[model samples]
Target chain A: MAASKCTSLSGALTRQLLDSVDSVLFDCDGVIWRGDQAIPRAPEVINSLKKNGKRVFFVTNNSTKTRQMYADKLGKLGFDATADEVFGTAYCSAMYLKNVCKLDGKVYLIGSNAMKQELEEVGIQPVGVGPDPISGVQIDWANVPLDKEVRAVLVGFDEHFSYMKLNRALQYLCNPDCQFVGTNTDTRLPLEGGKAVPGTGCLLRAVETAAQRQAQVVGKPSSFMFECVASQFDLDPQKCLMVGDRLDTDIMLGSNCGMKTLLTLTGVSTVAEAEANLKSECPHRQRMVPDYYVDSIADILPALQA
Target chain B: MAASKCTSLSGALTRQLLDSVDSVLFDCDGVIWRGDQAIPRAPEVINSLKKNGKRVFFVTNNSTKTRQMYADKLGKLGFDATADEVFGTAYCSAMYLKNVCKLDGKVYLIGSNAMKQELEEVGIQPVGVGPDPISGVQIDWANVPLDKEVRAVLVGFDEHFSYMKLNRALQYLCNPDCQFVGTNTDTRLPLEGGKAVPGTGCLLRAVETAAQRQAQVVGKPSSFMFECVASQFDLDPQKCLMVGDRLDTDIMLGSNCGMKTLLTLTGVSTVAEAEANLKSECPHRQRMVPDYYVDSIADILPALQA
Candidate 1:
């Protein structure tokens, strides 16, 4: 019935799936690379897909890197990619604030310098980027000098995230008119080994807890990410295939956008997890199940070569 | 007819309510004082309660100060109080880790020097109290040297709360055996002139988000704070009157512990809000509805005088 969902992408099925979609959107980190090292044959798969007259785009939730930085990293890893082909949260969030929110004033940014650069690229001013060391008493913090023009608070991956920054954001958010936006809700940034570090979600949660307000997230699973790419390239969702390692973010985003989804076993989620989602009664979990699963993005190499 | 819930405490009702409870637990900050100033005649009300042969105790969610500091503040405010008669999150959290969790190992404390002293007083060694400044890459952070003896992570109101602290907690909590504890979940610490600063809740939330585990909270509404006081003083919950300003923490704690709850108007929650909780069909909201409402804790003075 319907060729069975979450099937193994192999042989004729891989070729058939490739022919169905004109463009492939790949999630970074686990799908194409682990850390500094690229997954074996993942570069070949991406380059071959481009050579085969199919479009390829790299979409990542990591806000520490801008589009240009991502392109530079991709090139260093031997991947044939361009800055325009990358859609990171840093760039998309700025676009969202400018285009969707039509934010005219400055942003009280609790994020990296990359985010500041992205916001600047879009002609939006961002205040509070670096370490805002706590100096005064609680009353002093409550009365911390705030930028009068700051109309929004943007939370992302900030290495310098501190109590002062959190307090600043809360003070800005006390005015109900201030817009709150977050990059993504990924809890942990999985590294090369079993080791990991806290992600943007932690900082954002801290800010949310203080402000007593939920932030509008711009990363995966939200339609804005897919729409950001589609709007620029005029790409059709139905003719796009989303390949990712994570079921919750990448595959869920594909499902939300009505695009075909393929799960790669090289990342945070497993095939068993996808199957568990398939068998789950929850409609939300069901949306996370991919149409197909591959051992790695390298698995698509034979189909691309053919 | 039965007395209506959330009724205004005035005239004979005040005296009758006062005679009903043998002990009175007062919340600091909004209840007894606003910043450095006492709430009009709140100290007189507290001293009068003690003079009238009612045992009085001060319970606060603030983790910054030790019991001695609270007692000192109470004395300065003209309230008849002692260090033994005060229960704060700083002292309560230390008790929770030592007595409840039966923690025998060192703790990674994301709190203040007061918390450090409390932990030391309880014979539990705590490390990482001050600013753990960030240095090195993400991988370096993931592998940041962790104390092998640290078996618990305690979060409170840390002005030095940083990304490094959050990451360190995540690393410690990665060990499933490590205990996670928080002082309270009060989002804002209200200051004078309607200003506020981020509370312990924000810092604790970040750690929880990163750890992917809920902390054992030791403040208002958790029952631990009341139990800590009652166990030592041999006070009966039924004969205890929990008087406070906020409905969520103070009133909810009183209701949770089966004590009489009074909502005072001199603080965060309003009379209309308590009335709204009374009208709401939610069971949790119902718990938040205080049995009686008073214009101020000063209103009880006339009743005590009688």
Candidate 2:
């Protein structure tokens, strides 16, 4: 393992950092763009990584978008990427059910159709995707129809997340044998104008509190996500670099996988926040602080050119 | 205050316990009935309380039922109850908003029509009652249509609870002055056949997590509900007895309001659970232990007859 030598991420040291890793994993949304518009020079930097023979992968917790959708979005944004190189939670969670849990029965999924498509792509059947609308009274909810074939419950980002879906998920989770898997434990989803909404973690926790069970999160911060990438690409965790905007998820995932972490200030956390986490009494919080931080992912564009 | 000499409630002790408090508050579900059927002689015991000149009040965390609804249910079940004597969180929360918070503005309620009716009874208007359906994309959910007049976010049991409602409630709660109040913090509602459904606590916690704020809960274990009954009936907390099946809500509320607590075996908690709490090192948990435990509320019926 390369011992981190500096807290500062800039200039000639940035070039040395870029040269140190053969593979680079990037977190979408905040690092690359705020929304539709691309972050300044981010695309150029990503393109440069590919040009330099660095294995690049876009790892995101966004379960709403399919791999193909992400690939098309990246292509349109002028980044050198493909569907196989993008590992979204929707896809990885499906792979997790197939590879890790080895689930032979159907999954009671409380998520989007994109998740369903991903599960089907991996030859796994997923039920309860779209709106699980309230058909009867609240009392009827107690006797909610359960599928015996449902051996697992996978929770992700669902725009149509309703009480019916939540109840059904809770019912499925009550079984001790049923595997509980969550796409990510993101508490809040930050939006364009400094506004945020409850993330998948809120729904997962709701069901957890109701059912008294914990879920195995398959998103960043969990080593399972990094393992998915590593085992698939035959990449060594020690030689890979993870660049992300969030400290808890992206940087923590990198650190957990024994990879070097780079924090970009385009999203959720700031340098002061990272410093606080680094100095935190809790070992878990301290583990979340990045080894290095850049003003933006675009800061590496000049270094990559050099 | 009578010093409790024995943990067991029966025979001579039951009569003595009944003679102690002038005001008797009952938790409906477990103590009264498992579901539809009445728990043994619960009705006769309640009726006997009123006949003996004791002020009886039906206190419940269940917010789906309005005061009139609770009264009708009680009447059907053969309890001596009136709309005025029944205080569900729906009614208490509404009262809390009006008399306590002195809320003059509209409430953004994520509950049922029962909650709306209760809020209206107290001359407080409530909006966003049913579903806050999402018409746009998930990202559009960040900028949900907000009502500036909404000074409070009162959450209760709504069957039509959705992500849209959760987001809107969270948006309303983002305002520091916007009072957040939950009907109850019950994690799950157990049914007759060992089945259960996610309770309002899940929804309230989800919103609380997303908004990064704490709600002023008005349910049992909270003194606000007791104050609602106390201020209205001109009763002293010391002269009241709280009878409940659940130790966390009912017995805890009794302890909180400086009243005697009686735990009945017909509900969620057991005598063993109460003993564990009584022996717990945590003072809060210890306070939740009941002053007495009855095999059934019906035990008091025999005492009433004697």
Candidate 3:
């Protein structure tokens, strides 16, 4: 089976692979959708999977949206997904702090309003959302008032990410006891027409550089995202099929969780890159090799129908 | 000499060390002054070094202030310093672009007014200084109007560092032909009373992560800085003494240039830290160990008087 890694999914093999898993985990961007538009036949593939008694879930590293927001977007896109069936970094990071770290204090958040809502939903108070414009001078910034209750620094997708916010996070993180967590490490968020904006990873890198500390990431490729889903739904990793367009995040997450991994070609990575990873001598790159790949998620529609 | 590293400099040893060097380079922040206040007896040390026929220069990683601004600050603090004697990243970065890269077009700058002034001083045009607040959406950012004339993306100390600025840099850097340069890699700007703020390195790291490329650094430890000083002054590296507070930047820069190195305790590093570097088996750590350690730059006052 190891020797047959990164094989193309088609005809009989697609059905055989689908039958082996009781659940299918789909990465939101690129796998099932790109930006605001859904991928062709992605909805049918996901809907048919659920109709066949296979549970479907949307797992994404994007931290800008809450579970409910994802569910709303999914429903609008005809994915038939509920808020309970959605797992994004915003929700997963909240779960990681609540369940894994068992954090009792407030979080100094460098993220979005959706993240704030998600953290609040999990009974974790998050401070420092929205625009934190620079004021005074370097001395004022270094001595910026910090919340005594902030026991952790949470970094995610922030449009208003500024030097002041970076400084604030550094001040909080300077306390050795203060926990540091990041949503993901995806450097750029690819948009339509091959354009890309700096992703949460860029912001996270800046904060990590400033704090001089590594963040406990709670996004794709970190077992925590899979664990967040498994703990809630009692998922068997062996009976789950992880589908994503990015080999580094989605396929790597699948590989990390001991799940059957499928790479859809509607997004970031390509077949040549996957083959290169499979042929690589490095252990880390080898893990990024998916079990199977398709031109797009729509390729799985015929398999689901059969 | 290889066996004796990080020795305490005082008494007759200080005079002997002074006699060995015809030129002395001082790091501004912790070695000469802390924030707005000049270190006690620091001015005397610089003046005395000049009085004894040894050339004096200030080399700093700080990119926020222009050479004139630094000279004004030095004059206000009672130091006999001139604008031409300063070798800050702002000025050195301009020199790097004009001389080394030989940039023929305008620069997309992610830095301060000081950097802009320095670039202009070197007959180079610079764009994108001051506040570049976020507008529209992510797609708008990725498609932000790029100046076709921009041949390079230069990053330095930006108090206005934001996600938008980071995005703009990524867009310019997406063009492989566009050169990338960073002023320094200093992560934190240590302030008075043990407080600190995020430095240009944090901003540079964020852009590097987003652009998926390494930047050509123009600051300390990168021999370009020493070369910039040596070219105009015709310095002999062996006859120059480099004194600074931080071992990683200042002392390492001296070592890289084959100059006599002195680590002053009144700044970011300590004698204990220098000792640890000396004991380390790593070649990189060995280079960080200074030839001598001092309580402060003021300790050289007695040697100058003698």
Candidate 4:
């Protein structure tokens, strides 16, 4: 039912509306914390949802941090969350490579140890540098040598990267038949101290220019992460609520997957900025629009009740 | 003074004919080799200059290589050149810091080792990570622990670089009194195999955005290099000849410094391109017209002897 009739309702009405959601998906990073600082009412919102019997899950395109790590961060921030409540790009990447790519060869890994572990859990052998002594095509570069038998290039962020590695990746991509796959093309990664750093997007662009090839990005905006989420929770897309701060990611993902989207301005975006952007010409203009806009979780209660 | 009049001289005979200069300064990268491969007719023209008793020197904004290195590369390419014939940005950079800025603090070298050697020779101490106890502003990280007691920020090409170093440099630059300097702003550097890589210009931009500050470029367009050339060689500007492939750099530098300029079509700029650009409105419009335009150095001989 439309909750607009409950304009004068208080926290009780907000809880009642949240209880109606069978599945709730929250975007990590901005939605939870601006880098590492928790939003003012994030814990209260999560706790309220839990008390009202809502199934909550944290979703993120950040392949750097593991699911357990996200849960631990949330737990420390006064929000109770478990590993099962977290879903990350690393998990989705592994699933895509295993089910979609049909793995019979050694995989090259460019992300953190968590991604490597996730890939191995799916029965895919992970390699970094080398001539895969025995291989069909190289999947990612963990320790993989440039001259190694690379059949495909997989991209992710690696802090210890060099131009030499980028050059080799370009050389590999020069092969017409070789494929280029990126986990995601996120431009910035949240660092420890509220600072952001250039992520895989920068590296991907370097390779793209050098190779004169485009990569098939497999996470977020691709609908693959949502599909993974649906399958993991065994829920229909229409019944899920997607909550995030960024319109391009959260709202677009939800809209594309046929789910309801809510945009919070407490993260990277503000309501005024989103409104201004809505007036601009954007390619994804029609595909994504937030069903609700709130300044923070505290504001969310009034909006939900209204 | 303008050599014997030829049938080629059709219009504007009333214009004063200035005596031609004997010494010629040629820019290396764009003027001769576009990275690793020599532009068409570049070697032949350079060789012809020597045969015609025209004193020639290769001046480059690239601080990565030493004079001997440039000499070796030119010799391998069938061009006869001594170490003394090559002058790089490193020399001018060190000269500026030592004489103009009067900077005596330990510099955190951020360019090539050759640049470090040049700074050290100029009595500017180099400090960075690994064993060296550093205190002062980071002058460059072309080489890394880019973090130090940097009182100034100096930028140059360092292929093995990360955003972390750039971020730290930006932090140093946040101090209003801290000096920011760059060796050059060439967007792309030529690779050995016709490929291009992001050069120091890209690095400088990253820091510029982070610090919201513009850097004092010390190479090419700065006029400092040209001033150094004029004083060191004891040559009058009106009697000096600047020959380069790019009109924006070589020719513009010449015009700005009151020297005669020659633009060759064999390098970065083509005759058609120059014609098109000449029609545009620019701040340097008066300086746009070259004193001479020729297909190559081979063409210069006939024109000079006319």
TM-score of chain B of each: 0.98, 0.96, 0.98, 0.79
Better by lDDT, candidate 4 or 1: 1
User: Residue by residue across A221-297, what tens digits does model 1's lDDT show?
Assistant: 89999999999999999999999999999999999999999999999999889999999999999999999999998
- What's the DockQ of model 3? 0.90
Which portions of model 3 miss their true places by more than 4 Å? Answer: A1-3, B1-3
Restricting to chain A, the TM-score for each candidate equals: 0.99, 0.96, 0.98, 0.81
Order of models, best lDDT first: 1, 3, 2, 4
Better of 3 and 4 by DockQ: 3
lDDT of 3 by residue, A1-306 (tens): 435899998998988888888999999899888888889988888898889999999899999999999999999999888999999999999999998889989999999999999999999999999888898988888888999999999999999999999999999999999999999999999998888999999999999999999999999999988988898899999999999999999999999899999998889999999999988999999999999999998887887776
**Considering chain A alone, what is the TM-score of candidate 2?**
0.96
Which window of ten consecutive residues has the lowest lDDT sum in model 3 chain B?
B1-10
Give one clash count per candidate, in the order shown.
Answer: 0, 0, 0, 28
Ranking by TM-score: 1, 3, 2, 4
The weakest ten consecutive residues by lDDT in model 1 chain A span A1-10
Clashing pairs in 3: none
Residues B1-306, model 2: lDDT tens digits: 357521888778778877877999999898887778888788898898888889999999999989999998889989888999999999999999998899979999999999999999989999998766666875778787788899999989888889899889878887888998888999888887678899988888777877878889999889998999998999888788899988888998988888988888887898888888877799989888998988898878877876
lDDT of 4: 0.66
Record all residue pairs in model 2 with backbone atoms less than 3 Å apart, i.e. clashing: none
DockQ of each candidate, alpha-carbon based: 0.93, 0.73, 0.90, 0.10
The CAPRI category of model 3 is: high
Question: How far off is residue B190 in model 4, in Å?
Answer: 4.0
lDDT of 2 by residue, A1-306 (tens): 236521768888787877888999999989987777789888899999989889999999988889999999998988889999999999999999999999999999989899999999989899987777887865788778899999999999998889888899888888899999999989788888788888888788777777788889999988998999999999988789998999889988987888888989999889998888877799898778888888888878888887
